[model samples]
Target: MREPRIGIFGGTFNPVHIGHVRAAIEVAEALGLAGVEFAPAARPPHKSGDPLLDFALRLDLCRAAVSGIPGFSVNPLENERPGPSYTCDLLADLARTRPGEQFCFIMGMGDLLCLAAWKNGLGLGRLAHLAVHARQGQELEAFGRFLDHNAKAMGAAPTADPAVWSLPQGRLMQYVPVARLDVSASDIRRRWQEGKRIDGLMRPSVLDKLLTHADALPAGWGRPPAA
Candidate 1:
């Protein structure tokens, strides 16, 4: 029997919101993943500045968001080590610690495009599969062609499966289609600052944590100018 495949979805969950949760669900179903692990970044090399919540609090929100959700949980592995938390290192660590299981690093099309710039980025396929999910405002066919072009450049042979691209590094890059939501973390934060109703934007449990620690959020994310 094939080993169980797990989806490793890492991100700066400034505060885990609905879109993040829902997308993970859809991606899990699409890829037949056993579960999705949400790993919050301790210090994202790409991200720098305020309004990014403290690591502990962001970790708390991630825990709340996935609490009691079947086949969904949080992984604090990124915070386990010092310095910038790179996906390559995360996947390698998981591979080393958890044997007999296949891991697919879940990311969006944008991340895939930027993968080459990441630390040990090109070698990610050697560690595990790359699952690139859909995003809004990007042409699917164009992106598919782009992936094909990239795969060719890497000297990876083509497969009959259109959704799966086999990398020469002996792993795969999969394109997963997921439902797109109009919501985002920035919008959610903005609404909160404006005292807008954010009832359906996330789980009640997550909202509870957000409200309790809201004062810790950067003031720049607070209140908008009067119209």
Candidate 2:
């Protein structure tokens, strides 16, 4: 039997933006993934302060953001679970549901650096192959060092470590070229508060919900500051 070509894109998605969606699509296409699942962390252990939106609302926005996108869907794995969510735990759950499936864990360069600090970091290599998106101006050599430093203790396959996982011919991180976007979730939330139009930034469904719950969002939601 053929292995399932699955991609996992996880994030806080304070307010899902076009950039986030674009990144997922670009990676999925490049990897020839059969499907991509966007998992909004229920309560990110790494986030210092409280989430801007309630767990239910965050999940709703995530679902709306990828509603029409083909092969893209939101999973409630993290949100449904109690307590702070960990990537390792989430991957374990996925492995149980889809036995023998080959999974690809999609994340950014920054995430790879923090992998060693995550729970069950060593076991992750057994769950999925790592596919990290390169950050702008970030050298692959530096990333490779990070992997080597962390994996040496855990015994994770050095070759599978995204930091060192480069194509022989290219001598580059197996990267999927994508258009970089400057849009940030914080910026998006800020714009909504400043009464700026968010036509192209967020999905209509997500925008509607944000507008519906304007009062619950951060300080300036849907209202401009006094000039």
Candidate 3:
């Protein structure tokens, strides 16, 4: 029997939207995972796009978003650990703490493409498996080329299945395909700020909490200040 495995999905979850939740669901289903832990970043190294809410609030939103969802839970490990949260570090810690369970670090193909730039990216397989998901219209060929070029670098070889690659530390990197959910946190925040209906973009519970704290949102989200 295969060793029981769980998945770790790390992100700002800047108010975990439906897209984020749905993608995680797809990856979990595809990989037959025991559960997926949504770990919100306490301090991100990048993100010049938009200002974020307090880590506490973001963590609250993530918990609220996944609340009552089967096989999904929030992990606050990043919050406990000071300094910028990196994937390799998080997975390494998980590997140390959870000796009996295997872990799959979940991420998007875009992130996979930028792995080399991430802190300790290449060494991730030593820590845990990587389940990278991609949306339609993405360049799978590029990913294929990436797998081909890095096969030696990762000390991995192709399996009978083209999409799965072996990694040095008894880990695997597989490409998962998920439906294109045209939803994004930036778009959701912009909609909320623009005074538009964002009813269906996220879980209703999440919307409720966001509205409950609507006044707390940054003005830069596009909401004009009161005159």
Candidate 4:
């Protein structure tokens, strides 16, 4: 039997916009993944905000965004937890809980560039295969060289380790290009703040909810709800 392929794409899902959905869908297809889970970070270590919508509301927005999508679901592991969401911790739990399944931690090239700085970065090579998406012209050579330089110093790793070291000594990595989109949650928030139309910027369902619940969000974010 073939191993179940799972891709974990975690983020704040601040508004669960269309760009995020596109990326998830594209990566899942590119990697031939059985399913892709969007894990919203409960409290992202790298970000500070009013959380515009409370946790439950944010989760609800996420659920609404992917309502009819196939092979896509939200994993609340990070959302339910209180502290900062660390990728290593999440991967480890996934490895143990789903022993037989093959897991890939999906990320953008920007994140890959800073992977070495993440907690337990070296151990990540052993936790799950790293799947990164890049834009058409984004150079990945630096990342490749970084991995090549550290594969050995990192010691024996996991998941296709043998193949990893076969590449240049400092380039132990695999990359796949996925569709790129201009939509960003930050931009969405900014547009909302300016009272700009967000049509076609997010999933229809999510947009509706955002419009309906605009009253519940923090002041100065997006458009204010009708008086």
Candidate 5:
């Protein structure tokens, strides 16, 4: 019997938006994942300077955003764990709990470019496949080169195809194409702070919830206006 394929989609998800939902759908479909778990980080090691929304609020928004979506659910592992949330640790925990399942870490092109900089990034491939989502018109030649170098390091023959690469320890790296959305969480927050409309950027349920609790957010959660 074939092992169940699962995609791990992790993010701060300060307020889950449509762009995030769309990317998850695209990646899950492209990779034929049995399900996609949206893991909200309790404290992202990479993100500093600004404070994130409360973990409970972020998880609630995520749940609302993915509601009714087949094969989509929110995972609060990071929130429950102590200390900084690292992808490597989460991957390891998932491997331990879900043995015999094929795990894929879904990320964006920007994240792929900085994978090596991540905590224990080199060993991440061994824990799960890297499913990178390439936005429309984004140049991926650099990513392809990085994958090729890793493939060669793993003693695997490099291929011309940039979509998939063989890695050490029975892992794989795949690039999945997805529609580019100009929306970003920072931008969404900024718009909200400035009393601007963010109609299409996020789900109505999420936006409504945020609106209902706007007063509770930290002071100046969004970026400050340019000088």
Candidate 6:
């Protein structure tokens, strides 16, 4: 039997935005994934000093964002797990619970560029294939070179195609092009703080929840008075 393919999309998701939902939808359709799991991180190891909203609220927002979306679900694995969240650890947990399943770790081009700096970065390929979303202004040639370097390091044969690269332990990495959206969670927050319109940037449910509790936002989230 063919192993079920599941896409693991992990992020802070301080507030799930339309950009996020759109990317996941596009990637899942492009890869023919069985399902896409939006895993919200309780505490990201790489980010610091930025006050994240409560984890429960973030999880609720994630659930709301994916509501009524077919083949999409939210996973609170990272939120329930102790300590800072790491991709490798999440993959390990999934491997244990969902044996004989294939996982594709979905990420953006920027994260791919910095993968080597991640915890147990080299082992990432062994855990799951990488489904990287292409970003604007990024050189494909440079990306190919980086993948070739990593493949060689893993004792895998290099390929002429940059879109797909084979890795040791039968892992594969593929670049997936998705619709570009100028939306981001931080931008949404900033807009809300400035009392500017953010109607279409986020899902209606999430935007409504945030607006309903604007006063409860974390410290430093409000806009400063005009000079």
Q: lDDT tens digits, residues 113-179, model 1?
A: 7877889776787788778888644556755676666654454555687777787546677777777
- Candidate 2 lDDT, tens digit per residue, 112-226? 6777778876456666766677644455776667656655454443455444453322222344446677778888877766867777787788888877876677542344665
Flag the better candidate by TM-score, 3 or 4.
3
Which model is ahead, 2 or 3, in terms of lDDT? 3
Which ten contiguous residues of candidate 2 have the minimum total lDDT? 166-175
The reply for model 3, stretches above 4 Å from the true place, is 136-138, 219-227
Candidate 4, residue 191: the lDDT equals: 70
Q: Which candidate is the best by lDDT?
A: 3
Q: What TM-score does candidate 3 reach?
A: 0.92
Which lDDT tens digits does candidate 6 get at residues 94-145?
9998888899999887787788898987568888877888654455666677
Model 1's number of clashes is 0
Candidate 5 has an lDDT of 0.81
lDDT on C-alpha atoms for all candidate structures: 0.80, 0.72, 0.83, 0.71, 0.81, 0.81
The residue-level lDDT of candidate 1 at 46 comes to 90
Listed in order, each prediction's TM-score against the native is 0.88, 0.81, 0.92, 0.82, 0.90, 0.90
Could you tell me which residue pairs clash in candidate 3?
Answer: none
Which of the numbered candidates is closest to the native, going by highest TM-score?
Answer: 3
Note each model's CA RMSD in angstroms.
Answer: 2.7, 4.4, 2.0, 4.3, 2.9, 2.3
The stretch of ten residues in a row with the least summed lDDT in candidate 4 is 163-172
TM-score, cand. 6 vs. native: 0.90
Task: Compute the lDDT of residue 197 as modeled in candidate 6.
Answer: 82
Give the per-residue Cα lDDT of candidate 2 at 203: 71
User: Residue 198 CA error for candidate 2 (Å)?
Assistant: 3.6
Give lDDT tens digits, candidate 3, residues 1-227: 76867989989887689989989999999989899999998888977456788788788888888899899999999988878888878887887887878999998887888888889887787788888888855656776888787766667688888778888767888888889999988787777666678899889988888788877776435554454
Q: What's the C-alpha lDDT at position 217 in model 4? A: 64
Give the lowest summed-lDDT range of ten residues in model 5. 150-159
lDDT of candidate 4 over 1-227, digit per residue (tens): 75767888877777888877887788788778898888877767777665455667777788888889998887877765557788888888887777777777787777866777878866675777667677645555654666666667555332453223332222223566656688888787877666678899888898888778766765525444454
